[model samples]
Structure formats: structure tokens, C-alpha cells
Target chain A: MRSVVIAFIAGTLFGLGLTISRMIDPAKVLGFLDVAGEWDASLALVMVAALVVMSLAYRLAAGRSAPFFAEKFQVPTRRDITSRLVGGAALFGIGWGLVGLCPGPAISGLGLGLPQLAQFVLAMLAGMAIHRFWFLRKGSH
Target chain B: MHNFTPYSALIGGALIGLAAALMLLLSGRIAGVSGIVGSLLRPAWGDWGWRLAFVAGLVVAPLLVQWATDKPVSINIDSNLAVLVSAGLLVGFGTSLGSGCTSGHGVCGISRLSPRSILATVVFMAAGAATVYVMRHVVG
Candidate 1:
């Protein structure tokens, strides 16, 4: 099978998982984030389950010489803790807190044909484009 | 909270983990939604196809879910248009600058035991919690 096909299947599974778990719901995520308010602790269960499976699976994959379909695993190797990382996460957190929608859920929200989701996605794309343009101009990326 | 869904969350999360694991095993990709989307923004040679397919899959998954389970895809937006736009821009810029989001840093990176990802997750979660605190408590 082709990598694109595999990627699509993986994405489908991911989206389905999010939907079934109601992770697609912003209010639920906000509830999870809201420790001070009426907090919903169910999202933590999701994280724990996912983490357990992923950690075990990753350890197995890490030992393999190569992936079944691809030549090598392209894992993140950068280990630096730059200000950009912290600052970017802070901004992302603020946006998430405000709307309870992160990139994954936001993209999945596109399937619903809601104008509001479109608005959020377009603004997000513009933000990404602006950052890309700045980096290109500086020739630093 | 009106809806409590621990069983769904656990099953859903296990499914997500399986998906990520399959991506690693079969395609050598990190199954990070933001990272995949970000790469498509500035595509290298021969890097556009899989990313496009992945995004297409994302866009299609809800329809399939709706069909299979009779569950309408739902969201809550108490914020106005201006607030939504601002939040979108902030999330985009922040994810780009931070180099990952919940999937990349929180799930995949943490699973692999990366120090940078651990630090990133801690910072983002703390900040997210604080912001939520202020938004629900202090401001409103």
C-alpha cells in the first residue's frame, strides 16, 4: 500500500477516535482544562489510555530496523528548549482556552459545514501564512 | 458537566493510540495533525500528496462518523466572530511557533519520552489551565 493511503487510514482512525470520545466537543475540552470550575476528569482517562498504548507501541517500533512500508522513522530529534517554543505554546494555550478548539478538532470541525468553523480555519490559515511569510523574508527558516 | 464519557474516552484514546502506532509502523510518520498540516503549508518536493490525503481524511471522518453512529458533529462557541478569529490566529501562530500541538507534543512526543516534548506539554497545559481559570473565573 502507498504511504498516502496509510496516512489517510490513520487519519480516519484518529478522527473517529476523537469523535467517539467527544474530544471533538470544545466544551468538553474546556471542562477538562477547567480545574477551578466544574471540571470533567474524563479527558484525563483518554490521555492515560492513549499514553499507555503509545508508549508501549513506540518502544517496540523504536527497536525495529525500519518501518514496514517506509525506509526509516522520522521522529523528532530536536531537544532544545527555546523561548519560541514556550512563547508559542503560551499563545496556543490562550487560544485553546478561549475557544476550546485546537488544530485537530478545528480541522475535523470543517466537515460539519458550519460557517463559524470556516471562519476559525481561515483565520488560522492566515496566521500560519503570515508567520511563513515573515520567516521567508528573514531567510531564517 | 452535562455529559460524562469516560468509557468513550478510553476506547477512543486506545483507538487513537493504535492509529498513531500504525502510522509509525507502516509509514514512519508521526501522526501529528498540526505537524502534518504545517508541512503542507510549505511543501518540499514530493511531500504534498500524503499530507493532502491525511487532511482529506480528517475532513471526511466526521461524515463517516455521523453516518455510522447517528451522532451529529457538535461544538460550542460562546465567543463572537471577532473572538473566534482572534482565537484562531493565536492558535495558528502559537502552534507554528511552538512546533507542535496536543498530538505532536502531548501524545506522540510524550509517548516517545522526549524531554523537549515533556517540557512543552507542561508549559502548554499550565498556561491553558491558567487561561481557562481567568476566562471563566476572573473575567466572567
Candidate 2:
């Protein structure tokens, strides 16, 4: 219950931030990505600001034994550099560069009632299903 | 220097960081959108509630902002149907295979100084830039 509320609040804040920063705008994202033509450095500032605050927050979290609602910190523990990580990230980046919408903006944009966003999201889910069926079903990372 | 919005970008970024921090401190979780949404595809027992709540919050945020500010949320998508569909498929598959996306690896993982995340971030950024270069400069 408390965890759910916390999750909701966090998610809301994230969405609001994305909107306010104009990160929700695919054109804006593409502008930042367009290094060769009319580059917009605003998104770089977004990354810097987010990193500054998150780094400090992580430092604080480092001192805590457990979170308020959960008994343990749930975080990724993998360390090895695998082909899967590299290849997957590359593919994801290609997709992102192709259409300036990643999961966060794509999911948030659902509220706008846009048919295009719906189409993108449905296809994304299908892609996820494909991954689950092919890669996950094999039981190998 | 096109459409540069420094103030809003900074403020908005801080807000995102704050949300991520609160998520970790309050619930012991990473506010990685991909991980949150991806796990939902499998829907394990006793774990789908908060995930749904989080997604619902994301889905409702733009509406809430519009209602509060009396201004429609700003957004733009230039890609046609084919591009959108293919891109969506790639994103879904890649994020699942990679185990994180921007929020996960770019922000949270990097902040934690995780080597794996740093590498993933670098790889994705490079790939994204290269793709953009090809499409905008060469192909388009």
C-alpha cells in the first residue's frame, strides 16, 4: 500500500519532469540527437542536473540499511560485460534515434489520446513479447 | 542552438532526480521505466501492484498537468506509421534484452557508478547518434 503510493508519486514526478523539460517532445529529443545540424544542448543540461541530484541522493541512500517501505534494496548486481548488453543497448539506441520516443515518454504520452502513440506502444509491447518468447524462453541472459 | 530551454530543462531534470531518489529511499527500488514496465509482461505474484500504480501515474500525469495549467501538454512526433512501429519494436526488444533504458542506465545506473550501466549508456548513446547521423545526413 505504502509502496504503491510511493511508486505512484515517483512515477508522477518523473512524468511531470519529462513534460516540463520538453523531453516528452520527440522533436526536442531529435534536436538534441541531431549533432550535425542545429544541435540543442538543453538536453545535456537536463542530464547534468539529474545526475547532480541523483548522485547526492545515492550518497545518502548508501548510508541507509533499508528503504522505509521495503526490507532490502532491489537493484541490479550484475558486473560482467556481455554481448547481450552491448547489442541490446545498440539496438535500443537505433530505435530511439529513429523515433525520439523511448519507454518513458512513450508510456507517458498515452494520456494525450494520440492514435500514433497508441500504435507505437502496441508495437513496442509486441517487441517485448517477442523478446520474452525468444530470449527469455531460452532461460539464458 | 535550436529550441534551447535551459531553465525548464534543469528544473525538470531536478524533479526527475528527486522522484528517483524518493523511489529508492522510500521503496528500495530503481525508478527505471523500462524495468518497471518490462517486468509487468511477466507479472510475478505480489509484485504487479506497485508497477501498475506507477504506470497509471505516468499515464495520468499529462492529463493532470493540462487540467492544472489549463494548457495542453507539449509533444511532437514526426515519424510516420511504419517508422513508429519499427522503432517501437526495436525499443521494446532492446530494452528488455539490455535490462534498462535511459532512466535505468543513463541516470540511475550511472549515478550509482556501476560499470555495466556506464558501458551500456555509452553504447546506446553512440548508437543513437550514429543512427541519427545516417538518417538525417545520409539517408534522408
Candidate 3:
């Protein structure tokens, strides 16, 4: 119960961060991507700022033995490269370029209640379902 | 370059970082949206509350922010429904295949200095860059 609450709070904070940063604006994002034309560095700055904070937090947290909430950290074990990985990256790239909205920004855009967001979210969910049932399952066998 | 005020971005990033840290401290879980959302679909024992709350918070927090700030948020989509759907499917498929989304791996995982996350971030970012290049340059 508590953990769910914690997760919800975290996600809310994240969404707020995206909104405040103006990351939800696809034009701003596309501007950042327009290196050859305008070379908007705002998004880069945002990324760097995020990295700096994350670095400090990790340094402090690592000194401790375990996380404050659960028993221990939940890290994945797989390290090898695979097709799903490459394919996923390619697909993600296409999506980001086409719409200028990734998962985080897309969710944030939902605040506007735009029909496009609904379409994106639904398709995203369906894609996840397909991968979970078909690809991951088949790959494990 | 235009005159840049990084105050908002910095403050926002810090809040997100703090939120991620607090979530870890309080709940021993990484602030990964994909994992959280996935867990909601086929919830395990006693996992419904937090997932619902987390998603609920996502929806409500912005409303609160807007109410307080009165900043109008406008959403514009250049593509059609088909494009949006295909794009969403691709990202969803990628998230499952890669084992996480940008937030899960890119933000939280990278914060932990995980090697897998570093690699995943690289691949995903590169993929995004290339896709953007192709879409805007070649296809368009």
C-alpha cells in the first residue's frame, strides 16, 4: 500500500518536472533536435542538469547498505545485446522523431486531454502487450 | 543562442531527482514508470494501491500545477492518428523489449550508475537521433 503511494508520488513529481521544464512542448523538443538549423541547447542543459543531480544522489545513496524503502535495489541482470534491444531502440527513435513526444512527455501532454495523446497512449499499451506476450515469452523459451 | 534562463529547468530537475531519491528511500523501488504501469496491468499481491495512486498522481499533479500557476498548456500534433498509434506501439514494444523506458533506464537507472542502463540509454538515444534525422530529412 505504502509503496504504491510512494510510486504514485514519484511519478507525479516526474510529470510535474516535465511540465515545468517545458518538455511537454513538442516544438521545444523539436527545436532542441534542430541542431543544424537552430541548435536549441535548452534540452541539452536540462539533460545535463538531470545527470548532475542523479550523480550526486547516487553517490550519497551508494554509501548506504540498502534502499530506504524495500529490502534492496532491483537491478536487471541481463547484459548481452539482442534483437529486441536494437529493434526497440529503432522504434523508439522513430516515434520520438515523428511526434516529438516520448513516454514522459507524452504522458505529460495528456494534461491537455488531446485526442492525439489518447491514440499514442493506447498504441503504446498495445505495443507493450504484444512484446510481453509474444517476444519476451517466445525469447525465453 | 537565445537568452537562456535555466532556473526552471534546474529547479524542476532537482525536484525530479529529489522525488526519485525520496521514492527510493521510502519505498525501495526505482522510479520507473514503465515498470510501475506494467505492474498495474497484472498486479501481484497487494500492489494495486500504489500503482493506482501513482497514476492518479500523474493525472492530478499537473492539474494542481496548472491551477496554481495558471499557465496554459497547449498540445499540438502534426501527425495523424495512424502515425501516433504506430509511434506509441513502437515505444511500447521497445520498452518491454529493452526491459524499461527512458525514465526507468535513462533517468533512474543511470542515476544508480548501472552499466546496463548506460548501454540502454546510449542505444535508445542514438535510435531517437537517427529516427529524427531520417524522418525530418529524408522522408519529409
> In candidate 1, which residue ranges exceed 4 Å CA deviation?
none
Ranking by lDDT: 2, 1, 3
Clashing pairs in 2: none
Q: How do the candidates rank by DockQ, highest first? A: 2, 1, 3
Q: Pick the candidate with the highest lDDT.
A: 2
TM-score, candidate 1, is 0.96
TM-score of 3: 0.89
For candidate 2, what is the DockQ-based docking class? Answer: high
Write model 3 residue lDDT over B108-137, tens digit each, in one string. 877767777778778876766666677777
When 2 and 3 are scored with lDDT, the better candidate is 2
TM-score of chain B of 1: 0.93
Could you give the CAPRI-style class of model 3? medium
Candidate 1 scores an iRMS of 1.3
**What tens digits encode model 1's per-residue C-alpha lDDT throughout A51-99?**
8888987888878989899999898899888998998888888888888
Top TM-score: which candidate number? 2
Give me the candidate number with maximum DockQ: 2
* lDDT score at residue B118, model 1, on the 0-100 scale: 86
Q: lDDT of candidate 3 vs native? A: 0.71
User: Whose lDDT is higher: candidate 1's or candidate 3's?
Assistant: 1
lDDT of 1 at B117: 83
Q: Identify the CAPRI category of the predicted complex in candidate 1.
A: medium
Candidate 1's displacement at residue A50, Å, is: 1.3
